[model samples]
Each structure stands twice: as structure tokens, then as C-alpha cells.
Target: MDNASLKKRDLAVLWHPCSQMKDYERYPMTPIKRGEGVYLEDFDGNRYIDAVSSWWVNLFGHSNPIIANAMKEQVDKLEHVIFAGFTHEPAIDLAEQLVAMTPEGLDRVFYGENGSSAVEIALKMSLHYWQLAGKPEKTQFIALESGYHGETTGALAVSDLGLYKAPYKPLMFDVMTAPSPDCFYREEGESWHDYSLRQFEKMRELVEREHKKVAAIIVEPLVQCASGMRMYHPVYLSELRKLCDEFDVHLIADEIAVGFGRTGTLFACEQADISPDFMCVSKGLTAGFLPLSAMLTRESIFQAFYDDYEKLTAFLHSHSYTGYATGCAVAKATLDIFQSQPVIENNKVLAQHMAQATAHFADHPNIAEVRQTGMILAAEMVQDKKSRTPYNWKERRGMRVYEHALSQGALLRPLGNIVYFMPPYVITPEEIDKLADIAWQGIQLATKD
Candidate 1:
């Protein structure tokens, strides 16, 4: 019932994701009892703002009444059924909406339980499509350096982040890596557009050489979230799309983190005026209400798998909870909220407030860069600002900031040395100021010797 008791029980039985279990001995887990509109209440009745949107999944807010009511109504009627042949109205309706909302040419929808599974489904589908088209040699994939797709074997194989994929390298299939278009790596006095265009040469060279063996190229669209919130220009996507078309390679846009108006646009690919072959979406699909993910693809790719069972060309990938009625209903409600309210327009104002609130960090001596991409903003902490020398990862500087922010009643989880804020759409401008103030204090505490 209380924080201490719950911590003891949880530590005894639970293994948390992306955490070193022994660290819990020093920093106890936060026992959240309930959440409401950008705030999570702990068992002790202390409230902390959900600055990261509960791992960037939440959209409208935590415990949103609209989504909750839809879930309740759907569960009352029908909770779930096997998705093999028994289809329901909610599932069918949600799929239709997703196909319509996404960019043109994405006419088919495939269901999965999570983002990683969605990426795996796309990867398998691309390879299988090539096999059925008499090009079995097109078996390889290309990913951006430091890009993260997911943790599954197929997803990890396409990802280039060593932190998650190093230990499992032997288990993963080989993948080619292209230099990231992250603007952080751009030279002095260079524009993001120019640098991104320059970076595309590496990808062009790689794809041109290996197009015959490459099945697809997977990217995280505008912002590479898992890679410390590193971002790039929209022009990169436009050029990448052209290159893929020239080389007959499929472009898979992993919009799991940057989709659903997080990148200022409904979809990041829209800013580039391009449509990817496979669009993997999740996280905010159900507004953090349930586990649901979808892979939207073009009709051309879908047709490659539409063959007789005797030919063994049918795609057999599936999840037991694929297209759950409750999840589908919640997703429909989430979309309804988008339609009813000016979510994207409101976010534009909120994003301006965020930019103004954190602008002071740009002058801080220990802060290298203060970057903003729509609702997501990050301030990279460095040991020296001029040289941009990063603090040793072993020092755990980001953890110090996290602990400080927790004491100040805010949940500003840093991605390594990069402190960031990705608040829900329901957050007000005043709330943005509060989080900015807390983050500033945390940064000072973490930077002090």
C-alpha cells in the first residue's frame, strides 16, 4: 500500500526493463498509485509531472476519461477473440482509420502487440516479399548509425546502437550501417539541410553498391529517440526516399516514437513530402491505454504475399493478442480526440513555450546544445561547452540530474547525458515552465563538482 512496502515486494519479484537491478538498492523505485493529466501520484501522495509522457507513450494524458470510457464500453461488449479469422468491428474500423490517416500508398495494415514486434513484422515481410519475387539474394538491411528500432532479434539486427545490440551480436543477422544524419554531428557554420544532404552521400554509396543484396533501409524518421534524442533535417527523408526508389529498395520508417504529432506534423514523412514503403507505428496509437501496434504498407508489397498456401508464400507472422477489441476501441477513441480537438495546433503553441522556457540553457557553460523538435526538447550536458566534450558515461551525470528532478517533484528522465522533456499534449504552458525550472536546477546539481 505504501512506497516502502511496495518497493520491497517489487524488487523481490520484478525485473525492470532497461535498468541495472543492483542500482535499485541505492535509488528505490517510485511507487505510483494513480495518474491524471500529466501528473503521477505516488503512494505517499506526492505528485510528479509526467514530463516524459510515461516513456513517450501517453498523448492526451494519463487516465484520460475519453479513452478509458471507450475501453470500458468495448470490454463490456467483447474483450478479445482470436484474430485469425474472427474479426470485430473495432479492429476493422481502427485499421481503416490508420490507413486513411497515414501517407498515401500505405493501403494495408498489419497488427502487432508492440513497437518491436511491428518492426520485426516489417523486416520479415520485406525479406519474404523479395524471396517470393525471385530475388532471394536481396536479404540484407541498412540502418542509420546509432539508430534504434527495437530489441527483438530481427529489430536489433537492423539497429546500430551498441548499448543494446553488442552482447547479442552473434545472435543477430548482419546489417549494413549508414552514417547518421544527426545535426549534432554537423560541422561548424553548417545548416541542418546542407549537412543532412551531405550525409546522404554515404547512404547513397552504400545502397548503390549493395542494392542487389539489400531488401530495405530502416530509419527512425525525423528524430532518433533512443539515440539520445538526436535529430536531423526533413530533407534527409526526401532524399532517402528518392535513393530507395532509384535502387529498388524499400524504406521502412519507424515512427514509433516520432509519430502522432510529436514531430510538429501528423507524420514526420509528411514534412519531407514522401511516403515510406513500410510505416511502423505504436506507442501513442492507443494513447498509452493498451499494448497495440500496427504496420502500414503499400498495396504492391501486400500483393507479393497474397498467394496460394501451396506456394508457401503467405505471411504467417501473428500475435495471440493481435487486434484486441479493447485496444482497438481505445485507439479509435484516441483518434477521435485528435479529430475533436486542435491537438496539433495547440502543440505548436506549447512547443513555442517550451522553446522560450529552455532558451536560457543554450548559454550555460556545461550545456552543449539546447535543441527542440516540436513537443520533444533536449539539452545535452557536456563537461566543457566550447569543445563539446562529454562527461564520461561511467560518471552517471544524467542520473544525478534525474535524482535531483525527482526531489523537485518532476519526472525528467534523461537519455544518458541528454536531459529531455516530452510532455503530454494536455500540458499547459505554466506546467512547461515548472518542468524547465526543475530541469535547470537538476542540471546545475549534476554539473557541480
Candidate 2:
């Protein structure tokens, strides 16, 4: 069907996530026919670069050959099987590979379907472990003020973003929110390290004072993607690790968005040279081809529940497609591509090019900050550069940039006023420059006033 017909049918039957249906009246849905490499073509043949990696999932590229072939092959052997009492080759191999590659001590893997489910699994596991260890009072969780984990009941409880969680507050368990280490609000003269270190004091105080009741302290290591791509120093992670160890509280690293070489390392915690008690991974886990998430935890935590079935110590969690063979096979293929190709090494060059390409934005009168972390680059737009004042949410300035980008043949989705680029790993330097140029022009028009 054509774009108009598809959108009409979609709006009649389906509702998109994180969007208001009313907005579709002004901006019709863009139906994507197919995608190749870093570009997606709509039904009407209009092409746009997949700058946000289709919500930060696509790693290698759209319809990657290796992953496609792997999934296709696995489809014939075993699409899926019961993961409770049975095991499959793809799932076993992926688990072994993950345990080997992930940070030390995360030797067990519990599978889920998506990022939010992964967060729920981690939260449940942490709480269960504490109960099994005879510390049932440790039922609370601590998260950053602006942290965004997921939208499920358990995940939403730990998340502090008001936009998505405010309405659900009545259903969620109250979580202690520590001051965000988002260095964007730091004093002008303070370095990122100093600012992050200073802000860590807040978390330290909160955790230390309430360690007895805190089951785990969850954080999006290095970069907080949903909170406007807010980033901080590695020292904060290192210090948090030390504090978690000292206080006997589990540290859950939500690396769903920042893992798999997105943050210049295999895992963001690697940048801090520390290991978390629990690490929730998804998004790029299956190269955006299929839904798959895994919550990796320490052996001690796993052992806490490894008791007799009748003792009620076993952690009971199950998803129908927990260890689907196709998802596991494609995930294994994604990891294979990472190891076979110079993906991480190449990203360094591409990241440098991206920085240099958008360097001109630093002088933009309405641009507030041009922050970057490896493959991700964000430009924060403001109403007044001197005061770093943001545009009202009702104004939807970022939507202006989004509309402008569509007209210019690049998909530049902004988080509020922060326009970011998180293209597929296969994106070329030339493609990077093209996206940067489109973003620059779009920003100019959005903030034109």
C-alpha cells in the first residue's frame, strides 16, 4: 500500500509509543518500506539516514547480512523452545559468550524480551537475593533523579523521569532518587571529573544512610541516554562501585542503551574499570533485529536462590520467548561481527569526524552544549545561551528540528531540545558529515524564533 493508505490504516488500528495520537493529525506517519545500511526508505521512496539507530538499537546496520543469514539459518532448526527445563545450542552458546566477555563475576544470565523486562528481571533478582539472604527489609532501590529505566511497574518504580512516570506514581513503590551527576548543570569553571565527583557525594550520602533498606542502586553507567543524553565522568562509576561494596548494596548497571561498544568500550562500566553486581543489557543485544534482553548477575546472588525447589528459595521468573533460538543466533552473529571487524577501532575515527563536523555548532547562539560520548553526540538547544534557559515543553522546539530534518532527507529526532546522532556502526564518515550538516541547519531553523 502507499504511505497515505498505510498511515490511515495504522492510525485506525494502532497507537505509537511515547507519542500523542493528536500530533498525528499534523504529522502523518512515515511508513518505512525497507532499510539498508544506514538509510531507510519510506513507501513513497523518500530516504532518510537512520541517525538514532531506530531508537538506539541498530548497531551494524539495517538488515545486516551476517545477522540476517544467521537468523535465517536458525529459523529452520529451532525457532523457539521452552527455556525453563530445556536448553538450545544458540542460547547456550550466547550465554557462554556473554559470561566470558562481560565484566568479572557476572557469571549467570537470565533472559527477557526487552530493555524494560531486563530491568524488571534485575530488580526482582536483586530483591529476591536480599530476601533469601535474610535481609528482607532491603526492598528499596536508589536511582538518579533524571534516570529513565523502563515503563513497566518494576522498572517505572526505579525511574525518576516525571514525564512518563508521574501518572503511574500511585502504582509504583517509592524509590529514593539521588542527585543526577549530569555535568551539564555544573558550574562553568568546574571540570567534568570535579563536577561528577562533587555530585557523587549526594549518592554517597543517600546510599550510606539507607544501605540497610536499599536493595540495589541502579544507574546508567557513563551516559544517561533518555535524560537528554546526560553524561558524567567515569570516576562516578568507580566511586559508586566502591560505595556499593562498602555498604553491601548491590549495584545494578543499566547498560541497555550504552553497551556493545556504543560508549567506546564493550560495556560502559569497563570505562571505570569496575564490575557491577547486576548488569541489564538489551537494545543492541540482537542488533535490533529481534527482541532479546539478559540480566547478568554475580554467582553469589545466583547461589542465594539455588536451593531445593520445595524450599521456596528459587527465583521464579519466566517469559514465553525467553531464549528464542532465532534471537540468540542473531545476537551471536552480532557479537561475531564485533569481534571480526574493527568496529570499536573504526568508531574512534568516526566519532572524531562527527565531533569535527559539528564543531561549528559550538558558536550557535541558541546552542547550549555540544556533548559527546563515543558514537553518541548531542547538541542541547536553549532559549538564552547566557542563562542556558530551555524552551518551554509546550513550544516543542525539538519537533521543529525533527520536521526540518525530514524535509532535508535525514532523520534527526531530538530529545526535547537536545538533538542527538546515534547512527548505525556501519555509517561512513561522509554519511556522518551529511547528518551533521542536516542537524546544523535543522537546529538553526528550530531555534530561529
TM-score for all models, in order of appearance? 0.99, 0.99
Runs off by more than 4 Å, candidate 1: none
TM accuracy, model 2: 0.99
Flag regions of model 2 displaced more than 4 Å.
none
Candidate 1, position 448, lDDT: 93
Against the correct fold, how does model 1 do in TM-score?
0.99
lDDT of each: 0.94, 0.92
How many collisions between residues are there in candidate 1? 0
Error of 2 at 105 (Å): 1.2
lDDT, candidate 1, at 325? 86
List model 2 lDDT by residue over 369-432, tens digit each: 9999999999999999999988888898998989989988888888998999999999999999
lDDT of 2 at 421: 95
lDDT of 1 by residue, 45-89 (tens): 989999999999999999999999999999999999999989999
